[model samples]
Target: MTTPQDLLIIAMDVTSSRDIGQGDLSLALAGAELVDLIEAGALTLDDDRIVPGAAWTLDDALLSEAVSSLVRQEPYESVEDWLWRRGRDLFAAYRAAVEAQTPVAAGRRRWNPLRGGPAERADSPARRRAEDRWSKGDPVLVGLAAAVGIEHPDGEGAAPADEAVGTVLDAVHDAETELEAVRQRRSIENAAFDNIWRAP
Candidate 1:
């Protein structure tokens, strides 16, 4: 099965009309990777920190590598930091995977002004279905679309889309907020300790 991150790349390719901005797409891909890890039970978000979870036995190579990297890092890492460092590479990986499966005719490389370089855009029945699944409220798709700023309706009637979007926005906001607080507290604590060390 194609992972949520893969599907998201396809959706963006089809919907962006060859004008996908690299910055936001990278951010979305990075966020999707984290979401994928969380779903696989390999990692969990505790406020601003990403905590290692149970061993992941998944066969997905990319996700497995991500989990390994996370585990090898210090006890915890901030979500924003991870995303900033890894988003572009993850987005590139997704783009490569899509092009490998899709024919050159259906998925074409063209100049993307937003990217300031060549970019791939894919159009196929599978891509269409990916979008449809998102609109129908496949939870992963919905969350990913929301995370990446894609406009996919929840389709559960009037309130569902709003609620679903709200949920994702809240999660991202809360994570960033908590991580910032942690950084601030640590900075203060380190400064006080530094004073003690200097006193001697």
Candidate 2:
């Protein structure tokens, strides 16, 4: 089954023309993965950092790896730090999951001189499912779409402003803000976080 992280990545492809940066997309997928874990009862927020719970033993290898890395980190990084640290790998994993649905070129689009057009990632059917779910107010999809600044899926022309979705979006925003704050604190700190945040 396509996970929430897969849907979020696919949504980025459907909604944005410009490439979503690695860091940005990674963080977003991290947030989505976190929410997915929570929904599955595998993880929870303890002081705003993800902590593994009953569902930590996920069948999905990518999520299992993410949880395992979170478990091994020191000083108990906040959701933002965890996401920032794990962004690339999480994004890559989710990208693979999404691409597995409809195989496509790796990374983003490229100019194909012979075809005289851009090489594109395959359009994922999972994205359509997510969009349909979002229109029906699937909180996970709504929350993720909101986090990525996509248009509300409801077609009523407004993203959910409800407290639950608000809370999820807030967590995502907090992660991003925390990363930015760390970036501004010092160059070495930024470099350090960048280097060691991701799981090996």
Candidate 3:
């Protein structure tokens, strides 16, 4: 009497029962992990995984429980798609913040005494390029901050004077509550799928 369709219904009932007994929301991860295991099959989606897109399938509709588990994990390639997407890495954020604290100029980096250096000798392309690169270091860092969404959170608001890089990082750091919610959701989904996949 255990047809494939019936099997899905059974799994749902079983997981629901476990969920009720545990009483702790964190315990929901077991159920989610079950579904993940099943969907992952022989390959995983983590960095160690060599074969990409192994879990890109619709096998969970047949599972009696956690149909949404399969559906959720399928679209997690980019940071924005991750259930708990964090800010870009720390080095990136920090550099952005520092850059925001400073300012610089563009164009051929000529050695101007105003920049705490002696005047460049005329016709020296090497010195000119070197000066330009050195003077633009802070600008480059500021650009990094901009790339990391720094204009709004690490240290201050996205304003004319605020250090956008640090402000962005700060904002992201302050989002602990939001991050927790994403983690909890992912945990629960993973729990639902764990049992479906296993070691060889």
Candidate 4:
């Protein structure tokens, strides 16, 4: 039986085919349930499940939706040439990588407000108040906290104005494209392998 702990979720919602809309993917942490989702066809595995010779196929939009629901992470998508050169099985690695990006960095400064942007912590004692968690006494601690905040731009918190979710999904989509292509090519290869392995 598949358990939630064994699998992960890639939740994403892109408005259209052109843009990389914001999304989250947190379901994969519990691999077993995730595997169950995949087995039941409720959630499609990025490249691995999307490929030929697999149990099912997911369209681009649906793929985006799958990417938006769970914890969001930067998926491991290799360049087209790179994937072809590596002879990887599918986009499973990339999808898994991206899905895994979260929790791994959960407590890190990466999730702080103003991700990848300037710090609200450094602007004197008053300014840092609204931004930092380590703002209790100790001038050195405050300074250190400010430094940390400035370095890790927590996009959602730093600039809530920007469409951060969409940006995340777009990245997922881009990675999936290469995985999808590789999947198709692998289909051809798989057929050959099957024919050879099961030869009369």
By TM-score, who's the top model here?
2
Per-residue lDDT of model 4, residues 28-125, tens digit only: 11222232234445444344322112234334332433333333333533222222322232234434443343232233332211133211111233
The 0-to-1 C-alpha lDDT of every candidate, in the order given, reads: 0.57, 0.58, 0.29, 0.29
Q: What is the lDDT of residue 24 in candidate 3?
A: 18
Candidate 2: tens digits of C-alpha lDDT, residues 68-125:
7766344556766656676765655665676566555578564222223334656666
| Model 3 lDDT, residue 1, Cα | 10
Clashes of each: 0, 3, 40, 46
TM-score of each: 0.60, 0.63, 0.18, 0.22
In terms of lDDT, model 3 sits at: 0.29
lDDT of candidate 2 vs native? 0.58
Regions of model 4 farther than 4 Å from truth = 1-161, 197-200
lDDT of 3 by residue, 19-111 (tens): 211111112222222223433452234431112233434443322232233333433342122212222222233223222322223443432
After best superposition, candidate 4 residue 59: deviation in angstroms? 36
Candidate 4, run of 10 with poorest lDDT = 5-14
